[model samples]
Target: MTDRDADAALDRAADEALALFADDRRSSGDRRESHVRRPQRASDVAETVRWNVADWAAADWGGPVPQDAHAADSVSNGASNSSASDSPADGSSKGSSFNDELFNSDPFSEAASADRPAPDDRSRQPDSSPEPNRPPEPNQTTEPDQPADVPNEAPEARAHATPWRAARTAAARAAQPLPSVVRPLGEALGQTLAEPLAALTDLPSFDTSAMDGWAVAGPGPWRLPSKDATPEGTGTSTRTSTGTGTGILAGHAEAAPLSDGDAVRIATGARVPPGATAVLRSEHGKVRGEGRELYASRHITQGQDIRPRGQECRRGDALLPAGALVTPVVLGLAAAAGYDELTVTSRPRVEVLVLGDELLRAGLPHDGRIRDALGPLLGPWLRALGADVVATRHVGDDPEALHTAVSASTADVVVTTGGTAAGPVDHVHPTLRRLGAEQLVDGVQVRPGHPMLLARLAPGRYLVGLPGNPLAAVSGLLTLAEPLLRTLSARPAPPPYRARLTEAVQGHPVDTRLIPVVYQHGDRACPLRFHGPAMLRGIAAADALAVVPPGGADQGAEAEILDLPWTADGIGISADTATGTITGTGGTP
Candidate 1:
């Protein structure tokens, strides 16, 4: 059936189910408006029921859904208590409510079971093709223990939010670009250009020699002035009796005009003298008779070894447009094009607040206190991610101190590590509540870092709360902080890339999984060990995070990869592909 037809069918089915429920409710004297006043728990259950009905309706028509949706259906369908109303007045209603029946009695199942196709009916069946934009139904199994139609429990059911979706939402909300600023070319590295880099004047500005050669007016057998020669009929050596002005060095100006058949010694990058037809290599042109005569052994072309004006670019040419990333090479080009400074999108100034009193600043972990890993890691990582981290302060779990620090800070982004959860010392949420901060992302479905969050502290300022675990914090950084920073800095998103998984990666039943992976030969991504949310070993050695979809990916399956900022920009990590270990000046990531 076409998608339109299926949608129509589902709509009709929904109307019929609602009508049946209306009749049942009327018979039981249950007011529909009572649902609105139900307790929060009951309201949640009712919503789940509605979702389950929608699932069965979709399933009856054979539409596939994402695992998260499917798991919700399973939870709803397993509810044996089929009561539309749980009021004290209606103490018992043994029969299934219309709502419950919709979830339990799938219409397609009944139709298929009650009317097995007759031999004659089967012969007359028409050929069918899948409707456009309609996903083919997954093959269902009928295992007695766990029916094929029943979906597995979703991993997301236990988590607070989905990682990628939350990140995208945060980026969309903070879509405004930061203020622009003019910075010296050297300081503009890693910034996004706010204006096009146009050449001030034509490159070269004049015809110049491409190499150290003789500037010739015409074909060789050209004669040089006897003053440029020695008296003994031998060519002038490096030590010439002639003045320095006689031979052209690079940056030579006020050069004597060349006449027809005249040759002058020239150096690389020296402007060709006016009236010169071409340049001949010093070795190619034989200087004889005390340099009085120069003979070209090989024929010379008009433009050979000469760089004409505007060879690289014409005057006022746009070398790079706005929104381009200012790399070292771009800075060099801007400098060469006569640009002393560049107008670039300003970096969001970020202040990192490392929470948790349990975190130790130095020395190995003694007692229960572990060394503060994020304090050292976040500042540099934030810089690489295009934020200027103003300060990284260790704000212990004191609520008053955290509040004071946050209220006083003026940075565009406030990154708080740990204390996102509602534990005894978790003051981030309370502080944000006290400050009236707007929550953007409260938590994520990602493993090892489900407690990560994003909040808007003030206009043009945000707070990204990362879980205390090291690896989980890393996940939150990439998932939330990176996208937000990129948007604020007006940097374009990097194009998506995918690679085959060299090994199997266990997937979250519903949510997406981001696993630390090193890219291998043959464009394959190898999942690293020690990938627990608390462990940093895998991410430290990883090249990128392979985004495995809801269902686990088998070996050789294609997986989308999220490249770490350092991987693409060559920040701290120097990746040795052969050894599959990344090294940096200060060590690994």
Candidate 2:
């Protein structure tokens, strides 16, 4: 059958089963009792109920059963007693209330089960002997004694019973589509390439000297006559030397242009005059008659000390591809290539709003008011990412003020710190919803920044809600802010490096933990002391954030976390073997 038909069939079957159960509960007066509890063996019940609506959903849809499906099954099967036992006086007349709750609790369970593979037909059913009078024993064998050669439990069965696989299967089945791409580079960094730039001229356009010396003739055996040599001797000896130094040669008596045997003094980076082919250093040459007369101690060849034109880059070549980031090095290269201005991607504008009435601007805390940490914290971080902070406003916890601030800002990204929780005072979440923002990550399974929210305000505009706590705000920025910046800038996602943990860390099994850490070497990373959302001091002191992965319940487990450097510019980790010093490169590592 088609997918739709299969899904409808599964839904109908599940509804019928639920309807049958509801009818049985209504007809029977024993409302407090569990469903199908008779002399029926637990194994028989388990086998009969194993492939519930979720299993059918798995078979119909395509993947393994979802976690929520199991949760829904547990709740649906367990809630029978509570719902059935309620009397008319107790206000339990709403039969659909229990179904509604179960349905709402897990919307995808039925769909997930329909997607899963069908159960094996070879499996035999267990005997149905009721054990309602006796308590269920843990890990009890219910199957009849079989042949010694035939194994009761298959290895595959044992493997399929793991929770991790179930969770992974559920996660895979419930995967959502990736968000649409927007102007990624423009939002984060203010700089963008106007067009693809090609080199107009070669680097070091002309051949230049690299040393302070005399540019002379070819490699040689030089015979220098005395400066006071006889006129006849001068002519004969000079003639002999002239024939040997046919090319540009050293001067016999004084440093002069090559008339026959001449050498001109040239400094480093000085242009080599015509006829000059090699360089003879002053230190290596002997000055016999005052400083004018010189003799070469070592031989040299042509073009030995010259830096050739176009050695680094050629003219008319592609210097930087279009859409490449215009960094300091790129700017320098462009300038060196004789370009005055570079056309780049436009910088994305960002506006920050700090919301809360309890936030104190500065000075000692008065009464119950705390100092505003977001203004001092996020502003510089945003700027470092190349975003132009158009405005920063501190608004009270009033939803109207927040709406006003957000509406007034013309920035591409509007970041609001505080009031994201479910408390009565929390208003950011509701305000964002009212503004028609599409939530990306409603609430990440993370500590510190658990309340952090990501939403798209417009095509290119984004609204990021940060937790009110100082550390939580920072964590939120690292997790979402940095990624948003990169997306806005159109920069590629950075690759991660492996680092050994210096100390053991413990965390909740459900939440992903972000710990402040300092990378000692390029490979060794250690967590900083005193790290938490409320602790601003610890965040300020941290060099990089070490991300502890999800499921960190065990101590001493190695974590693979994104390394957020202190500076938001880029990854900065420098280890000097000579000095044994570690430095961050100021970006995501």
Candidate 3:
């Protein structure tokens, strides 16, 4: 190794040693072994790769070792793949192009080929890998923090990424819903009902007046009963009167039974008196002089203006089935059914790790750092998709820190933004390998978000890695996170819908394209500008995503639509009906 390479490697070791000493999580006795975790296979390590930091630094260690690509090529890559001395971190040849990545091949390796040349015989795959041997177009822009040369993933993973539909399915099937929880009504909003919503009591348990009116036995125009008469029942429905009735009030005890041909004044929601066969609405009835008698201004039918017992739901009846979404309306229904709390499927608790050393939390992009867009976008977006975001921590790009954060997480799902691509600082794949997590969806056959992935961290826990770009991350959110959260929350899948295209759209030769679109005249879907993976303008103003099939779609063709949640803070897509082009009001974000 060169002097510089030696110094860097030694520095890394010193840092690790310091961290081990400072670590409060581990026991002191556990540090008895040599900290240098080397590979078992002879070919896996070079003479230079092995270090003699005391006799305990043995050669046959069987564990993951995070290594730098330039330090020594003989050092094994984290995955099941070999490394080339001058090879790109990813196994793809230097000649691999971006077009081929989007078309005709699996694409888990997010190599930044466009930003820099692959080592003479190397490759790292990702969103910006340029077409081989071609100059970057004048309008082409590189993603932030993409250096001219960086170590990436092996080409092997890229060659076997899952397709879009299958990736979504695999994510949905990765884990089951968390255990049920009994949350109070205040906390159950947006949760899924774990059990059927059976009524604790009959809705409208007694025959009650539906309006301010008179409860009359037989027909009105009959003698008016004295208001002070005891509320004694003459029929099966009589309720005991609580006090002298000004009339029957809503919360008061039941009034005296009505004598045949007699009427008593009653308020809306008051229990109907016994012997009262029907209710005459106040406006429809009149009191004669001296108020001794009542007359029906309109025909009074039996049971009119009265809410019969159990009008809405009877006791023990299921008002809502299990898996029902608990919306505000549902909360009201539950309250009316006498539920102080509800049995709901526990929301999937998620911890978000925002990776990358070039991210700024609160400032203008400067000093080689860019503002973190995904950090703000994901929390609320995930909430809308039915997840409880427990924490959103900035984990940076250190492999060890990423590992520590991931391993220590108690959340049901750990979501990571950026570092998914096979770049030098891309520690997500390596960290996941260290944790023994299963990659359910390595990559996808979709544009802008092809590098997104889903993995199972443990039996009931999962992780979803999103691309670094803003728009690409959004695609992953809907494609992977949304489905996973929905399934884990026991929420029903939204019905798929399609819309006619207002204009023609180009499609990827093989991969599917998710384009932002807005509803147009005649319910057609209009594609928006600035729909690139890194751009967020189009999505901010979009009503839904138009799933354009491979090879493109013609104007007026029907395309599947994935609707976005409505937001008052969103911008609109204004269509130029004359030209068939769309301009979004959402400014660059």
Question: TM-score for each prediction?
Answer: 0.68, 0.59, 0.68
- Per-residue accuracy of model 3 over 1-589 as CA lDDT, tens digit each: 8645554565455445434322421232121112232322233233214221111111111011222322332332334333433455333577976532222111112231233222221112332433465543332223311111112444554466678878878878877888999999988888899999999998988999999877889965777644444445322232223221346778777677778898877778888988898988777877775565788888878888889999898999989999998888899999999999999999888888888777777769987678889877777777777777777778766888889889998989988988787777888898899999998888887776777889899999999999887888898987899889989999888788789987666554446778888787857888765566677876777788888775567778899998884431121122213312111111122
Which candidate number would show the highest lDDT if scored against the true structure?
3
lDDT of each: 0.65, 0.52, 0.66
State the local distance difference test value for candidate 2: 0.52
lDDT of 1 by residue, 34-107 (tens): 11111012123433234333322321211222233333334445643333223221222467464332222112
The candidate with the higher lDDT, 1 or 2, is: 1
lDDT of 2 by residue, 336-446 (tens): 887777665555577787777777766877776767667766766765555556666777767777777777667788888877665566787778788898766655555
Reference-based TM-score, model 2: 0.59
lDDT of 1 at 292: 76
- Model 1 RMSD in Å is 16.4
